[model samples]
Target chain A: MSLAELQRMTRGRGEPRVKQETPDNKAALAFLGPWLVGVVALTIGPMAASLYLAFTDYNLLEDPRWVGLANFTRMLGDERLHKSLEVTFTYVLFGVPGQLIVALGLAVLLDRGMRGLTFYRSAFYLPSLLGSSVAIAVLWRLIFGGTGLFNSLLGAIGIPSSTSWIADPDTALATIVLLHVWTFGSPMVIFLAGLRQIPREYYEAASTDGAGPWKQFRSITLPLLTPIIFFNLVLAVINSFQAFTQAFVVSGGRGGPSDSTLFYTLYLYQEGFGAFRMGYASALAWLLVVIIGAFTLINFWASRYWVHYDD
Target chain B: MRLTTSSARRTAAAAASIVVLAGLTACGTGSAPGAGSDGAAPELSEEEVTLRATWWGGDSRHPLTQKAIDAFEEKYPNIDVVGEFADWGGYWDKLATQTAGGNAPDIMQMDELYLASYADRGALYDLERTAQLDTSGLDPKVLDLGRSEGTLYGMPISTTAFGILANQDLLDELGLELPDTSTWTWEDLSDFATEVSEKSGGEVVGISALNNGYSLQLWARQHGEALFSDGSVSISPETLAAYFQQALDWTASGAAAPASHQAEMAGVGLDQTDFSTGKQALAFSQITQIPAYEAATGGATLEPVKIPSEDANEAKYSYLKPGMYWSVSSTSEHPAEAALFVDFMVNDPEVGGILGTDRGIPSNGAVRDSILDGLAPGEKSAADFVAAEEAYIGEAPEITPNGASELDTLIARYLQDVLFESQTPQEAAEAFIAELDGSIQSANQ
Candidate 1:
């Protein structure tokens, strides 16, 4: 419409409302345009394609052939898939909680006024920065290798040690879990932020009532911090389930030492790229989505009992 | 508020229009020049063509490969070749992804184990039909190694033989004589290695256990079985069990490094290996690796010997393996140009001299003979070892069966099980055969 007509419409009371509708819709569409394109092209498009491919047989080089639910049925008999799932679940079970405990403990210690607090915070946070990196994984291999630093340290203390921690199936997953726990900086920072937001009045009131420090923390700190803890817990669980690079690099990308370190994502990578079983990999991917979705849904459902939001 | 809303709408409209215009321009400029031109050799038409070439290797090989690509570009001014290289570990995954996306390099370096898988899936161009690549200079036997079902899908760049790599210095230090490799059985190997361990006061083992699937295949071949034949696992469980048992015995008797130590060396390369670092007297190696092992040991003389066999006359353990292959991608826009580059890599004496046994002995007989004098002492020894074993070199095993690539991980796991005493040799063997059979059967389906 012309500028004069638009102005005249705005001047009119009831008729102006009708004229405003088209331009308002256009403006909203313009605001949403880029994000809509991205969601459709990058996210939704791939998800749809993979959902279709989950039922097919694809080796990447050739066209995917329809096999209905054969890929899913094949997973029933796949021992490696079972092993990978077990390893992944174990990692998440221990690693997420262990990491959160370390992160929160350090965050609490740092919350107490101390000298060189920034330096300590940075130092504590450094491992997380380097945690998922390939270089750190390689360093992990050297430190845990037979005749390496760990064994050498043991020998210096008059204990004879010959085990390669990363190479032994029994200890390989544990070593990776240790690496996971070392990278608590991100969640620790989140917890620090959460602690800072808690008003000092509540703790003071608890103290005035002759409450012990532990009692004050238990009554005042934890309840107020439950929401943040819930948030961190969900994030940690999701991140742990998707852990790949550290296991990939440390295990030499084959998830070996008898598949002890075969995280779920690592196995999916092997099937998709290493073995060219892209169809099976797509099926695995969808299954992961379902698994993660179910876990998150359960966490939210259970949060009603524990997570307390002040607002 | 009404004025603000109308003005905001106008601003949004203007912003959206700009974005749409920018996107349109981007789409227009992104189209390649003359991308849809009709059937004519682009190289001959004075149209510039860019072809990507990818390979996996160590630090030394990358620069040499880049230099060769530069030389090719220099020779063919109309053709530009982009070189992609990585360490061996991540190369296959990258190549597989690129191939799946239908954007693989015009020329790719292939391994014998995965050559059949790629060729069978129609990811490789048939070299027999590519006229620009001359195969006449290559030995027919060497050339045939890259063929799948009589179709030439890969061009052999070099040849290597699997054998025992022994540190002569360590053996001499122990005052141990090298076993007669020509007729040595597995028992002889064990006894000799045990003697070395004893004499050295346990400072070194006699050998590192041969646990790789390729090594196991050699053992199976010596027993008149192929690892895979006719699209299935052909090695009997008895043979597989025997192979695992020998490894178990070696680890048990100090003929090989301790089980834990062997496990540590699983992902290590030539530089940090026990044999290369003088921690072990002997290890399994391809003849091509002799130079690397020699270099890693600070010039210690490393010698290649025949792999041990049970029967002297029936010892079919040693065979010439293709060091690597050069194959053209099926999706290459400029196949003729890629073929020319492959021809240069295979037949050019200068390229051979520059690469100089780094990729094993050259597959082309002419290039092989020309580069002999230029080879290092260690490389020369490897070449001599290959020549000496020509008479005993058995028939090359069937091009590795589809899905057989997974056998390496399976064998390593089973071998680890036996070494760690988690499972008996028979149990590991039974599991291994069942797993391998399943993999092959799935691939066939």
Candidate 2:
């Protein structure tokens, strides 16, 4: 629509509105220039390339040739791809909730009037900063390895477990889940901030009405904190789906113990770099985008029923 | 060495977009010739060329390599060599990315698995065309192993022969005897291992499972088959199944560490293995890793012994394949200088003396002899072992064709299936062969 038409429509609705350039138009455009370049260069450009590459046979070395839907067709019969999807979905389903529960619990505990709040917050926040790092993944492996710290602890308790938890098909993914839960620091901080934003007067009113701390939490604290919970859930879902490094590191990039920890992203890497089937890897990448997008959309649809706001 | 690489892929995706970033191989025989094959240093320009050389190794390698580079700089004052290195997995990932970006290092240390992959993609310069890299000093058989499409793309740097590194100290402590590895059959070894497990009350396991792709390859060779032939998964399913059967028997019979422990150990470097940690009595590894294992075990006496065979005749399956190679990038601007540097690495006594048997027994006979006296005790014994075993060494097999670089991962996955009882050996082998064949077909397409 033309500027005059937009202005006329606004004017017809209510107060007369005018469309004109702001004083900072040039400055704002200049300020956004670098970001625009970045979007076109890094994000949009690669995404467009990936979209195109998804349909063609591009091995990242040779020139891409047209191969219509072969990569996708191949995925239909791929057992490993299916396994990876299952693994990734399970990780998201269990990991996001597990992490959110841990995060929310710690956030509530810390939201109390406690001394050294800053110290506790920093200490609790540390894992998220180092969570996806290679060093931490190696540490996680050692902690759960057959002869490592965890087994030693078991031995000390006279349980005498010798299983390398990260190396057993039954327990491998569990260790990663625990690792995911341990890195709940970021969400806890968010939840803590959200808890603070819930005015104390609500709890006081609940108390006057003869509500216990548990009742106060269930009625007052929870409803107001749904937005943050929703926010953390969404972020956790997306991040967990894209989880790669921990599985890659712990499995040594083979996605082993019978492919129990084969995250979708790790499978994409195996196809793209390990197998040099960049075309198939691209198809896998687009599939993940679709999967994550569909889930996020579903989350949005579901959030409308539960999420609440003061306004 | 193993390095669980950082989540660089995630960072790359976030920072630069998806992996399908823009780039194409500059399609052509883009490489130019290097120096002449005069068995002398390439004539250097006075302009002071700077070349980047990269390799993968553990902690001890970086300093020794830098010291060798220092010597090379002294020899060719005008050429400055910059060194880059990483653990095995990270090195390949980084090198692949760099090559895709057309910014690959001038010199790269290539593995048998990946040498063909890179060269077939025209990512490596042809050494014969370069004329600067002299192959005359090395055995022609060793040199030919580095060739692809009848073109010499990489030069052999050293030799690798897979063996069982027996921890004599561990056996001695337990009052058990190290088996006569030369005469022992696979069945004999298993029974002996079972005894060790029983004697030790299951504390120290007898051996590590055969999870290394090299061991599988050697096993196939012993059975008169090949894991791969002509860029295809050509091993008979029966052969691979038998290998898996041995693994199953070892685990079931308690002749080796449990599958859980094997899964953990399989993904690590020699230095971190159960054998190196002195928890296990044996490990199957390349003969070159003796020093690293000794150092890891705090100077424990580990001796290299032949892998089990039916007889001396079957011992011919053991071959001194190139442990690794030195290749100049096809896109290198300083190919001549890079060629000279690689030449020095292969032939110079100074480099070999400083490097010792770290890279393996030297590929050049003269340099191998020259450095023998200067080697440390473990390295010297390892070198002596390689020399002694030469009589039994088989003809070096062809470097695995392009698409087989991932065979290790493929085999390890299938082995896990067998261990978990999720698949029978025959079933896992059948599935593995199908998957491996498809992988090769797709890459070659």
DockQ of each: 0.30, 0.43
Listed in order, each prediction's TM-score against the native is: 0.90, 0.91
lDDT of 1 by residue, A125-233 (tens): 9999999999999999999998779999999999989899999889999999999999999999999999999999988888899999889778888899999999999
lDDT (0 to 1) per candidate: 0.83, 0.83
Overall local distance difference test of candidate 2: 0.83
Question: What is the C-alpha lDDT profile of model 1 across B1-445, one tens digit per residue?
Answer: 4765777567555555555343223222112222233434334336898999999998889898888888888988999989999877679888887776656788999998789888877778777665688899976777888898888889999998788888888888888898788788888889998998888888898887676767877877888888878777888888988888888888888888777678778887778888877989988888888878878999998878887777774664567878899998877778778889999999999888778887889989899999888788888899998888787777777777777776676788788888888889888888888877776676668
Can you list the residue pairs that collide in candidate 1?
Answer: none
Model 1: how far residue A234 lies from native, Å = 0.5
What digit string (tens of lDDT, one per residue) describes model 2 on residues B1-445?
A: 0111134334435545533343433322233233223444334467989999999987878999999999999998988999999988789888877776667899999988888888887778777665567778887778888898788888999987788888889899999887666678888788888888888998888876687678987888888877777767777999999999998998998888788888887788766877877888877888888888888899999888888886655447767778899998877777778888898999887788888877888999999889887888888878877887777767666677887788778888899899889999999999989887777677787
Residue B136 C-alpha lDDT in model 2: 80
Candidate 2, A112-132: lDDT as tens digits: 969999999999999999999
DockQ of 2: 0.43
User: What's every prediction's RMSD, in angstroms?
Assistant: 6.0, 6.5
